[model samples]
Target: MDGTWLDHSRWPSAGRVLAAVSIMPALALAGWLLAGLPLLLLGWFRPLPMLLFGGALAVALCVYGARLEREDDAADATVWHVAATCGIAAASAVFNGIFHSEQLVIRRDPATYAQYAVWLADHGSLPIPYGTAAFGGPDPALVPSSVGVYDYGGAIVPQFMPGAPIVQAIGHWLGGVSGLLLVPPVLGGLAVLTVAGVVARLVGARWAPLAALAFAVALPVLYTSRTTFSEIPSLILIFGGIALALDTRARPRAAALAGLVFGLAVLVRIDGLRDVLPVLAYAGLLIALRRRQGRGERYARMGLPLLGGLAVGVGLGFLAAYSLARPYLSYLSDSVLPLLAICAVVLAATVAGAVLGPRIIPAGWKAMRGGRAARWLPGLAAGLVVLVTLGLAARPWVQTVHRVAKAEGDVLNAKFIVMTQLANGLPPDPSRLYYENSLYWVIWYVGVPVVVLATLAAAVLARRMALGRGFVWLLPLAIIGWTTVTTLWRPAITPDHPFASRRLVPVIVPGLILLAVWGLRWMWARARQAGYGPRVQRSLLAAGGALVLLPAVVTSIGTAFSPIERGESAQVAKLCEALPRDASVLIVERVTGERFTQVVRGMCRLPVAQVRPSGEAGAAAGANADINLAAPADVTRLAGRIRSAGRSPVVLAAQQAQLAPYGPATQVVKLRTRQDERSLVDPPNGTWSLTIDVWMAVPPTS
Candidate 1:
């Protein structure tokens, strides 16, 4: 190893490095909070604070960076890496927009997110009007039957965290409705670039572009970039934070910056906090171990600022949520205060343990004699393996207990179970879908060999960690492992092709890419050490890269040109255009109503209600139901009520049978839609054509 490998002086300037990484994102976050929080608290949106604070902070950072000394080491290589990453990201974004962009809102969650962004752009604050006047009152049925809208205190508020909406709002402000479509792809590109930077830090710059390419072209990345999913931005922050943390040894401020970024990630998605728990542990371990090695002062100087910055970031995140997203925060009301208190206690406990526990505990003192107990480590490992094998042999009984426990809380697990049922139906053996779909999606994308190579890379990294070296690399491994387990345990219930694969994009795909790259690099080094020529090493590496990437590239080519769903049909658009702004729309089928309520409300700016059959509005039923669709009398009564409220009542039904009792249809619209035909356990094929009748009837003249 060269001495320059450990020397900070050979690296680029801290300012340049920060510019290449986190500074812009941090500023943008600060600016967003500045502009957004005040609007939420004051009930008015103002752009001045955002511009002033963000502009001033950016200038200050630039000025400070200018004062720092500069170092040069192959500037062209850095530029190429940056350009390559940016190009890959841009191409991926374009590809995503072309194919995966949802024309009409199909999924409830994305629709809600889009609406929240629209609300933010227009109202610039919370308590988005339920637009109840269109529905004639503050009835629960007036609420859009979307997944992320919460009915709280007689008002409709978005249930998601504020981070992604705030980002989407930028797009809404810039380009109106079209801008919302543009935001995710841009963020997706940024995520790709950020992951490249992370790979460069963890592995080497030479491999960074390839890692970025692998991630940018993966099915998960391509699919997610086309929609306004929060995962994209969360990924940017997480990987960027990790990359920034790697530079902390050279630039102490980098640690604080990394902490702030990670903290913001939690604000974007609460699960991000769980993902970063390993980082906290890693930091604490560094502090404790360094102190025992008589490097206490240096470690404290760096670690304390990092911890403090993390607290600052977390504090700001909660503050933003409390001020701007109070209604959404209400969902977590029961646990928030307790969770905060617990976090504070844990932080205090960890700091104390790092500082004093090492001195007080006998195990800490005995660590100086570590060589004596090291020999027993192999025997202990063998015994643990034997015990684990025995446990696996008795797994059936253990699984039964686990199954019973899961069933006991079946309500909470209902969504995932429903997804499995949707994908595979009520089979004699049902657990296979969950496990099989999880593996199948991965295999479908990168091929089985790449999966094996990634596994090998993970094993190698694990071995390195076991040897008590390269602890820094453990963060990515921990994130990948955690996300993979959680996703497979309960993949999201989306009817999209690839079968719940979207959930794995942020961590799993990136992790696997990094692992594959590592594996290739390791192989090349081994080949060279074995006296192979440069040409052989290059050929081997190229072939490995191609094998790892070919499946995804081929799949993407096929799927990218043929989308599953088109935007709103021309006929539906015409109906929306013809419908009066004051019209009240009612959907007959409970399921279809819940799905399309947001589309009607958002696209047509009309209040829509769903009618459920009596006894169907159970505890788990959606919050938007006005009348029973099954009863002709109830439908007639709701129509009368709509007339009494001085609004035309329009009914939409999936079948002619549904509309027969109401009256003759006003018009029939044909919609070619994608239906989830998973009961047969076949891969979802092309769109299905369905005919829907729109009906309008006059109130009785009595």
Candidate 2:
């Protein structure tokens, strides 16, 4: 149990490393089967049952893993620490994945993602057909709904980056519909492992597990990881990329791999470009500084490989987008060629600057290096001044952005404005949800002292970065800062619960946790220097750690144990099971219809279509449709059309009133519904006892 055993010099053997890696997936598989098998056997592979079973099993595995790690010897503790971290992450993901609403979380975003995955599983190609008749011609029933599908050149395509779908498709291929739900959790677990590895590199191995544990239960991390969201995958790649980049000095291939991974990140989410910007800047800085090496030699050793890998990765990304997502580009009224050209130009310019600019600015570089404070302080001051001046100058542009967002029916922005007005009783109030709520949420989980500690850690890290002691860590810090500012500046359009806080998970939570750990380590080091005995120092550290982690632990308990709102009502599942697979369904209400269409097509494996009320086609279709069942002629024609298609006609209405004209529905299903706006922090609102009526009618005497 020597302290030296925990040193970086004591690397684990390859067998141990492989064992550590293998244990996670094995545990994950065990957890998944334990959660899924009971429901599978009981014929209740639905949301509620799966969530309960999966959550319990995951929790048990995490607890047991932690206990086992606690009992391990220091000589082989590193492997156990890694296994425990991965186990906790995997367990959390399994629970979250199961606990996530069985239905798509956000109708537009996730539904499209699920559909894309489903299509990939089935067809394994581009240009997903909206329906059987989608490619033949324009059918009003087949028109792209806002719920993630887009109309593109007489074809229907998913309106999203394909990275997440491609990942989810693997799940679909493996486990069918339920498998898609597993993708995010698995990626989530990997992301946690990556974060732990990064922390171990930047800080120490001892701190890695704590950081990972903090992140595993973080509200944003837990919530987002459960859903079929793109952010999880993007985070995994970005974190992994950064971790590899940090190791570039020792392992140059790691830099190449990092660049390739980042390139794939952009392929997953266009916004990932923002995250990688700092890495690019850092690479340029490395090239320009040429630390302890000849300029051309340094470029060849570090710059060339990184750039080449970036070029290759980006080129592959463009190729994938153009080849696999052509329909999506067409829908956006854009072409991939222009984007590819632009990226190529950027890459070329970067290389050219790295190669030529250093020579041109040799004297400037020397001068800047000669006086650190004189150079940096002025530059920093000027940058701040420019930022302020730009903020003042761009007021009109900012207003225009808000105006445009509002016009585009941004619900979050509108809600923010309303909330601001209600809170302050003022006109033209900018939304401060991100700024205000971010701090509150952080405190809600990690407590106020940790926030202070994190701030102090940030200052310390900034100093270390300024001294060039830990320059590699700066890129990730920059990403954290940039994303935090931008996310708070413009939060996603979502209810305050999951979405608002969820966006901050990838960077903010991890950044804060890293800083807190650094602060704790700093305090412990100071305590040791002040002549505290080993026993006293250990006690103080343990007490301090408890204080730092207690709030988050308590909050996590409440969150983890809370009942998840079931996405699909039992009645809906019953209806799906009861209805014939080939039956043609005519949904009277637009919102209900579009939402259910995905469920029917993807989960139930049925063909479903919607019919808007005559004059209400465009407007009513946008929101909820008010179907006029009193218009017998319209109902008769729709029923006749359904019957003509060689399938039984089944009509579904959200309201009983909408079904009266059908002369007594064959079945009426009462459903418990809640307002879609929800958050993990808040308890569920009271359910609305709504009824869905289903009618089986003969062809209207055609």
Candidate 3:
């Protein structure tokens, strides 16, 4: 892994620096989350307590980091090492700022995540108190619910795990909405560092900048990092966990910290539980007595601490899910048991292997360990990976993936798929899941060269793992393979580019990028062995690096500089200003209620309720809704009740005519912004225009 540019031999490896710094972010996030969740469940998640607690944890992290053992030889890091890392981070942060999305309205998941964070930041509590007293108690005509918020016993409960919001709440305290929005980009830049660290450890430190540059320009990385999505932070924890696990410094603490970090990812995104499954298996593998040099104690030390940390982290996540976000858990009931069952099965199997293998199947296990079988398995494993890729690539020709639209989300996703089909000029197939085209989706952003190189690298790595080789890549390959196969198999979200691309970013995108860089390094090494001159070797490295980077840059080129959802904070501010102070807000329109119910309640500091829909009107996370609110009579009655209770009733709708019966309709929010681009059959090149207009009026007291 010789660098063609300057001699970087004396530089401290990116891996070492990563080991030193990666834990801080994860520990901070975990510290706040672990402290915040219990308080939130008990309605005590305030700013002062959280700040103090977080500060204490930050201090502890610094002390712990200072105590980590540093090898004196590679201890001195070069200025170039620090500069390249910081420069990459700076560039990524700048890119995020340029294209940062203010998805403040509750129209999609990003907006939902944003609103959830805003509420947490401002109120520091869960199950937002309904403030039913302002409207003079409960009425059948009024509902206190919004898109991703559910009503429970007169309180508003935000859907989704509290981890992401808890992390984003820091941004709110730092500044306000702008600061809140800025956190994601900063996290995104940190993500660049995390990925580079993984590459430096597994690949060469020389390749860290290349990995950083490659993923920095990747479409999914760009898209997820610019908004309040859980993917970025989860990525940091997952990759940081990987980096920590590979770190030999302060072996016990490092292993334990790595486990804790992986566990916390489950708190951020539930999919993280599935993403870390391989680690669970790896833990078991380490626990099982391998006829090796270090003996059983060596493996147990590594395994036990990791297992303990993972347990605590997972326990915290599930506790938060069941307590703070029970409705979200209910909504995902169908998959929850299966995920747990799988985890249980993996855990049980791991236990069984560790406990019983020596007594029952020693010969067979030893044979598999280093016999002819072990030598042949790598080639077979590599071939299997290629075969699997081919199978996925050719799947569309033989099968059309589909999901039964039984659940509300499934139905909406079906509709989105159909719409995306129409947009792509293909025949509308409501049932089409497009899972068969998963391989093509990978190709769309990374290009054919990356796909090919990554596959080769995966195959090579697969072969290398058989005889106790390439220990650094063992868990990474497992995590990446496990997630890639499963996500591509069943992407359960809407089958649209950029939107569906999130499924790829967490592990798959960076994992493949790391592999592609490794594959190029592998190629260079082989060329060097073949007596190729330095010039030819440099040419090979440059060409391969270009293959790894160029397509991702080209793919993200369109939206890289073009910011979507711009001016959204301004529009929300304007709308908040238009709402009269001390006014009891009654949202009569379905879409308006869905988009602004919580906005008014939380942001405008008004007691707001929406008319209970009669029939065809329901809230939407990303689905299209009709402009009509069917319960004007219900709303009028509610307004009369509000007036009698000594409160002025304000009506909100999408159009002037809708609010005409109440009073003069004044458009409060005329937000014109760009929506995230959607493409089912191809790569998304640009964004679509989104126009949201909110009309408001005050009803007569008479």
Q: Choose the strongest candidate by lDDT.
A: 3
Clashes of 1: 1
lDDT scores of the candidates, listed in order: 0.60, 0.57, 0.80
- For model 3, residues 559-618, the per-residue Cα lDDT tens digits are 788788888899889988987787899888888898988888777778998887665433
Q: What is the lDDT of candidate 2?
A: 0.57
Best by TM-score: 3
TM-scores, in order shown?
0.79, 0.74, 0.93
State each candidate's clash count.
1, 1, 0
Candidate 3 to truth, TM: 0.93
lDDT of 1 by residue, 187-226 (tens): 7877777787666666666677788788887766766687
Model 2, 1-702: lDDT tens per residue?
779867965665432342234223323333333444334334444445544765566555434322222111222336566667667767777777666644442244655677766765565455645554312323454323435655565555566776667566657767876677777777777777767756665666677777778778776677667657777777766765665565555545445655666666666666566556556655665565563356445233565566566566555555555655565555433324454455557556666667766675566546666877644754464355335324533443444333333333445456655663453344543433333344455566666666767766666666565544565557777776666555555444443554456666666777778778878888889899999999988997787677676767666665554434353446556767766666666666555565565555555566655554455543445555443322345556656665565666666665655666665555534444432234323422222232334433323345
Of models 2 and 3, which has the larger lDDT? 3
